[model samples]
Target: MKKILPGLLLLSAALSCTNKNEKMEPYKWPDAKAPIADIKPFTRILHGDTVVDNYYWMIDYFKKGPDSTKVVDYLSAENKYLDTMMSGSKAFREDLFKELKGRIKEKDESVPVFNNGYYYYSKTEDGKQYYKYCRKKGDLNAKEEVLLDVDEMAKGHPYYSATGFSISPDNKLIAYGVDKVSRRQYTLYIKNLETGEIFKDQIDNTEGDAVWAADNKTLFYTSKNPVTLLSEKIKKHKLGTDAKQDVIVYEEKDKSNYIGAGKSKSGKYIFIYSSATLSDEIRMIDASKPDDAFKVFQPRMKDVKYDVVALDDKFLIVTNWNATNFRLMETPLNQTGRENWKEVIPNRKDVLLSGVDEFKDYIVLAERKNGLAQLRVRSLNGPEHYIDFGEPTYTARIGSNPDYNSKTVRYIYTSMTTPISTYDYDMVTKEKVLKKQQEIIGGYNKEDYVTERLFATAKDGTKIPISLVYKKGLKKDGTAPLLLYAYGSYGSSMDAGFSSNNLSLLNRGFVYAIAHIRGGQEMGRYWYDDGKLMKKMNTFTDFIDCGKFLIDQKFTGKGHLYAQGGSAGGLLMGAVINLAPDLWNGILAHVPFVDVVNTMLDESIPLTTNEFDEWGNPKDKEAYFYMKSYSPYENIDKKDYPNMLVTTGLHDSQVQYFEPAKWVAKLRATKTDKHLLLLKTDMDFGHGGASGRFDYLKDVSLNYAFLFSLEGITK
Candidate 1:
């Protein structure tokens, strides 16, 4: 049996003692009333189901209606309530922030990447919020030319993102994009590197990437829809011409498909890619011919997704045509069609061919086997071999290998106990050199920590992988606190990567574990297929099972186990709490997508149409009921619930702020428990809070403080 702390034991007993028919005593707090959102009583009749929502008006901020002020005011009230309730830990939060921030090396420089006759890198100075993008010509010892000083450029802006630095083929000019607001809509600007002159031409609402044509005077970029913020059109622009007159090279007809323009690695062709959840199409034109129309490489096919990579005489395709696990196929440049594609690397049942990095003489394939990443180097006409990571479980992916003529390939490797390390491997000589490893300013010792890969059997008989890390002296008596985390959606695998911030938890005797659930591609394509759409329930159940497994193994007691997830994972947190309300001691949901049915039903919302395949179209009736059945917001009942700290940003473009805000409003009014249900909203930021490096640590510190306060740990 697991030993439980007195406070946790009391909380658990209160929940276990509560009966469904009786009103349970709410846990007493610091004597502050949680925000009560005004009831508007909105009715929705969909698929023969009648639903009335009291906090539906919370979405008025996005609608820009009269209730917009009310929405903001309500959010402010919740923020104030959270502050007052957690006021006891105010000083602790600040100290925790400094401790987290102190681990980072204040002055840092990235490994310079050699591209197009220049070695480019970004370096950050101590105390600066951002970095300076600089490049050296010929070699590393050459004079440095600072392209963009983002620290200086972000002077007056609260949220500024500078990205997509595209240098012209001639290397005399450069184009970049900037977003002052956190909405992800970037304004493209061109600058003359030779004379340091800022051009008058500017393109607005672009996806940020600017693909330069061989002529150096023309550029191609993807434009986004103002409302949905979806990449909708590819346009061509001349150096000195007005953006209004830019020609529309191609426009995506299907709202589900996102389109983007990019140059081939060989610099021989400019390709426009259109992709959806299960389908893809590519169009290409010669880089020298900017005025020429792009020819279709492959027509979009249902349930068949493929990506193209250009080479000297052939184009490689990574596709799922007949293979559930993707395979590599190649076709001649002249015959760019699916019919002409010949299998270069046949599909294997065990290994998933994720991607390929092309080069002049060698090709590096990124493969995944048994839920771990691997890099395979293959010579065009020679032998192939997998690069040994020397670890049973770790993530290894092909990094930057831009120069086609270089025999060496760059790859990144990291494990739960290992810091992220970069390496350059000679594909021909089979030799590898470690370029750099992440430096933790406050010394770290791998020997002081223990990492383990465990398996938890799900209810459906599937073995779910769990990656965990803790301090060396961990006891299996279940007295320690454990935090289980996962993001089981979009085929995104939550691999075990090192985090300096996680040291704060491990050092405090908290066992941090990642549940490699079904929805992720960790176990290959079948794993993802079994956890999405109608089978989405597997995701929630898998996470619940993982937590139970941890408890069964005496890792932690149910009252000491905490759960966390963000975005889609937040949905997981919400669902798990509803399905197994008494299972977790505390939950931290970051920008949670709790309102699933309503958000999926509304096509006007950004990313809704694009996600129809992932979540299923609710208009079909079946998906609507299925989604509502597990939706966190819809399933909230008058029951004892775990303490939760829900966070969101006012300008969140991904999972909108209204989802969490409304969910919290409903939870406060509905839940019987008085456990901490605090909602922290970053009013100035969006989905990803704090653009600055040190600023994000503050949010992390607040989260740590919440967990510490619950466990009664104050440093």
Candidate 2:
């Protein structure tokens, strides 16, 4: 008879695979733990010009408390080992170069917008900012130079900062924003990218999102006073020796409304959409004066109830909500004026319009009819000629603007089960060619990984979806360590996606799961509406239900389970830990919004009032009672809870570090056992613990080490 050990038994066997001779010695764990450094109240995190990409990571850290901030670059020396981002080793750079070169070449060339070849980073040293742009192309030595010196650019303005920049297509002028003492209000500046000379004219506290018009001299941006979504106005600014700033368009002032602006393809017209209260009705604005570049569009869209998708000189695609389902409706640009409206694509009951892109004679619609989301192109130049791009293996999500080169349309595709991969679909050839594939994060195989959707009944008998991922072959034993994750707030859904880092856990014999609870839009708007304000406790109970369901199915035991969530989900994690602390072995709360009541009470905080709709205002008695019910900071009680590791950032403007600090302090004072409450705050970084990639991974590795330690696997 042949005997085979189950996965749990095998994992336990593997964890003990260390040398017996070493195990014989007394366990030597690091005695000294890194102390929590004292942080200043007004510390700010720094961000790099480089986007958070695959091989590169940007991190901000404070060597000396809040007074100084430094940005560090983390480059993965090799794709083989997902390790450090910042190291003074030359061998690491060589490995990084080899991996980066391989990945860069795989990118689709049709979308020749910007390459992640150069490093653009700015840092403030000795109260002066030093900006540099370095590019390493081919065998060419690294072309690195100072792009701008902060002191030379803005002369008189005390404490001038440049951020949110966009470069002209010709790469001549750089449109950067300069903020005063208050980061909220900023003025736009036109700086010569090469000369580093800036001319500030359209400087106003109300100025917001800006984009360069094709003319480069003309700037189109959204501006508003007090920066409210309700009263935002779109304006145009001329940038030259002598320029003018004017309100090319103005939206109706309504507290409960939101106005969004978009430009047409030909630049002949600018489209403005008005949503009085709900994001439904979209009105178009045609410039009243076509000759003046800073002209406002006429305010009126035909009573056609729909959401704008794409607008061009020829056609406009909109997601129209009929009596039942959301459908795609297209109208000719010529007839889409104030009183004239004709539907090119009429409303269909079953189809849910996702997105659309327009070319000269054709319009491409990305729609989800059944469960399938595919791209469909319709040519209006001829009769109703249409072509389907076939059902993609995964859903195809189109960006705001997809690059079209000759006869090819390039876009990206990904699904709950597929890794994000880009492709270029040839319009004429009707062939789909793969452009780039994400690195095949090894250590685990897809065939061994299995995902299933389960609905668990909560305390209120409401069914919540739980996405579970684990190794395929596992016995129905109550010994497997389970990591139940959830983020149940702000209508943010924990969608299915691949993570190279998560692969570490799967290989180490852990079942990973996400509770798609209420207070999120995973299912729909109603899900979020149900779990916020007075009903916020539902998030906690739903998470508990997920854990209970796993135990009921004999997948995990009480001491072998862990609950984790971050941000709003962090609130969920903290609440659950306090409510039922004995249920889990450990918990990880990352940049959590735990101090709910106090934080929401102050309107001065960023995103506080804006979130009033989500979390009821604490001022009202009814709201106060309900909000305090599940707020982690307000509800800490005397109990022997599981070990918890809470993370926060001193520079975090969104979820202040004080919230977690207060919560941890109270938890320590109240809890009976020495419930190892570790508070790690990145003094220089914001909500994200670190700015660079390697720094993030290092923290992540430390977190996992702590978690694994609680499971009897310590260094």
Candidate 3:
């Protein structure tokens, strides 16, 4: 498993500045995170072990809690993974605990948490639920404690599954949602963490996110109860007593009772964003009481819809529509018992506000333009200036807790290209410093690999951007094996970044390319619109175009090309293989959303009806006709297709395992020839395979091996 040390060691100490309000400059990237970044095939650290490039991420030293140092060391050291090493859990946990006991003084028993980072995990065998908690044993990397026994909490509730929960700022009050399966409604409950006292009587079905009031005398949360046909009702829970006071803060009586309430750090006003299915709006409400005195802050342009991010108590930053792309605007909030408003930052067409966090004197915004996200800071006192933190080597995302403190300006920035690192920037000094960077067990070298951006036109004449990476000196001849990856659905953007395993593929002379297709927001909402509903066929055609483009550009031969995509993108891969399998040597479909017509037509399906907007509703005869035309599973025909590696998870809640399971079964049963089709399911994980990082790497490696097998690369 990959053991990335705590994020302290990965950051390069460098500072650069730029003008924020000045004319935009071309993309100038920063230095690589590592100086000697050769494609690290493996890394060995601390304990006696080794980690392979493919499966290294499975070891999560961060989960070890405060003193993750030892966990990191153990993870940095490679462990045995032979048949003998695959013993039962008890022995494995015992051995791990024993090895860690010397470094971690805390005597908590070892427990396995889900590696996806979602607040859900189950045992390997029984699939019983467990919760993650921590104890401060003076070790920053304190051992994590997993509480598995939920029989008490599950009593009297048919929907004993955990829904949503929040721990109070002081870590005292724990509020959680308990869904009742029959009513299809979720009830909220409160528990005192310190006393271990449960207040079940205070449970109510209508509550959503629980927000603590300024005085802490009452808790406010949004709810839609009493079988309301109107808007969601907001309610208050008075602490200490088994009482719930219901108050209708806002009501629309519309089909969309969707309302989200968020309290500003100052505690004077609460920002409420409400929308139906298509568009959304942001408004403000008085935190003190329920009244018509609530004021709505409408966008300057009604055509320009938006979402709000509270930059500070007085200013609410908004992301507004700029054609298909989104632009950011900030307006000051006047919660003075009177309706008042003013704009702080007007809309700028050239830049997209990618990040924002409020500080003592300034608000920081990381804006993206021309495929690059830059950090810029604006002060109420001084002119706004771009914090020339330098263009990150990869796509950078900035975020921070809403609690406005002196240190709140220091934001946690992470990228798919770089390890998660924390940085502190002084609003006063206009200076920046790296707080932490992730540690790599293996050494690195920069000159060993290269990345480039290329463009290709789709069958529909739309230009598709592809990010290409491979060893620096690979010849342009159409001989090298190529891996074409695309996830062109759900408005998701596949960003450019550094991948430890992908780099391994690059080092192995395989050209890795990401096809920025129609369904993603890379180009904007229109791009997504073009690939969804009846337009879904464009996604596959786009992939075909990309593969053909690769051949035309002489990047690789038709026999050396492989196509890969998962989830919605899996649908893309399956469709492309069906329509033009000759273009690819092999196909890797992971947790695919392939059975569209049947699945989307059924209202009983988990995500079917809700996703009708993204994928056309198959319930309608017209939509059914449209979806059937492109549904991969339904459209599968007896033809010569690429060798396929089909991967799925038994417990996938999003795209059910039955889809892939049934698709593979049908393909195997119906296909005419010996086209090799492998169906691998990691019975443990859900939509994400294998719980740990290393486990996921193993899955990916096996998948790559399967594709490479088609190219005669595997034994």
Best by lDDT: 1
Which ranges in model 2 have alpha carbons more than 4 Å from their true place?
A: 1-172, 176-209, 222-236, 240-306, 313-325, 330-396, 404-411, 414-418, 426-430, 440-445, 459-463, 533-535
Clashes of each: 1, 12, 32
Which candidate comes out best when scored by TM-score?
A: 1
TM-score, candidate 2, is: 0.68
lDDT of 1 by residue, 377-458 (tens): 8999979998988865677888887788889999998988899999999988899999999986656788878888999999
Clashes of 2: 12
Which stretches in model 1 have alpha-carbon errors above 4 Å? 1-29
* C-alpha lDDT of candidate 3 relative to the true structure: 0.56
What is the C-alpha local distance difference test score of each model? 0.89, 0.56, 0.56
Best first by lDDT, ranked: 1, 3, 2
Query: lDDT per residue, candidate 3, 673-707, as tens digits?
Result: 55556666544446655432223445654665555
**Candidate 1, which ten residues in sequence have the lowest lDDT sum?**
17-26
